[model samples]
Target: MLIVRIPAEGIEDFRAYEDAVLPLLPEFNGRLERRLRNPDGTIEMHIISFASDADFENYRNDPRRITQVRLLEKSSAKLELLSMANVP
Candidate 1:
């Protein structure tokens, strides 16, 4: 999962960044399983999954994704990454 913190002014830019990038997930055998946002819009959580760690890494390092880093930078967004497993 990704926990994101956004500044008020950065919200549009952040959403734009997400819109531009999230679609690339499937190329790496990944999916964005869910997205949740706080009522105040200060925080967002994205649940993502990939076939394997290597696929995730591949997605991260993909040139297309790298190019979109500017959109994320433009948004001045802050992010925290978490790895999760199901409770079974």
Candidate 2:
């Protein structure tokens, strides 16, 4: 799972980022389980699942994803990423 905190003003840029990267998920054997936005629109959270650690790593290292990261960095929005695991 990943939690992203983005400034409200940059939501459009973030959506662009999402549009660019989401297609790549299936290539890495990953899935976007959910996307949640705060009612105030100040934060966004993404829950993703991968078949394995290697799959997740591949997604992280994908060039398209990297490019999106750079674009996001250039935007006015700030972001935070958190990794989480399921608890049984």
Candidate 3:
């Protein structure tokens, strides 16, 4: 999962970054399960899954994604990634 906190002025840049990169998920066997936002619109949460660790690594290293993530650098957004497990 990715948790994002953006400055009010940076939300557009953050959304643009996500818009440009998210479409590449399928190329690396990734799935975006859900995207949630706070009522105040300053925080966003994305739940994504990949077929395997290799796939996740590949997606992270993909040139297309790398190029687009520059948009994130343009934004004043803080992003944190969490590795999650499903337990019974």
| Highest-TM-score candidate | 3
Ranking by TM-score: 3, 1, 2
* Model 2, span 4-73: residue lDDT tens: 7777777778778878998899999999999898987667778888898899899989987998986577
Tell me the tens digit of each residue's lDDT in model 1 across 2-83.
9999988888888888888899999999999999999877799999999999999999999988888887888788999999
lDDT (Cα atoms) of all candidates against the true structure:
0.91, 0.81, 0.91
For candidate 1, what is the lDDT?
0.91
Give TM-scores for every candidate, taking all chains together and pairing residue i with residue i.
0.93, 0.82, 0.94
Q: Write the per-residue lDDT of candidate 3 for residues 8-84, one digit (tens) a residue.
A: 88888888999988998999999999999998778999999999999999998999889978789888889999999
Off by over 4 Å in 3: none
Alpha-carbon error at 21 in model 3, in Å? 0.7
| Each candidate: RMSD | 1.0, 1.8, 0.9
Which residues of candidate 1, in runs, are more than 4 Å off?
A: none
- Model 3: pairs clashing at backbone N, Cα or C within 3 Å: none
Between candidates 2 and 3, name the one with more favorable TM-score: 3
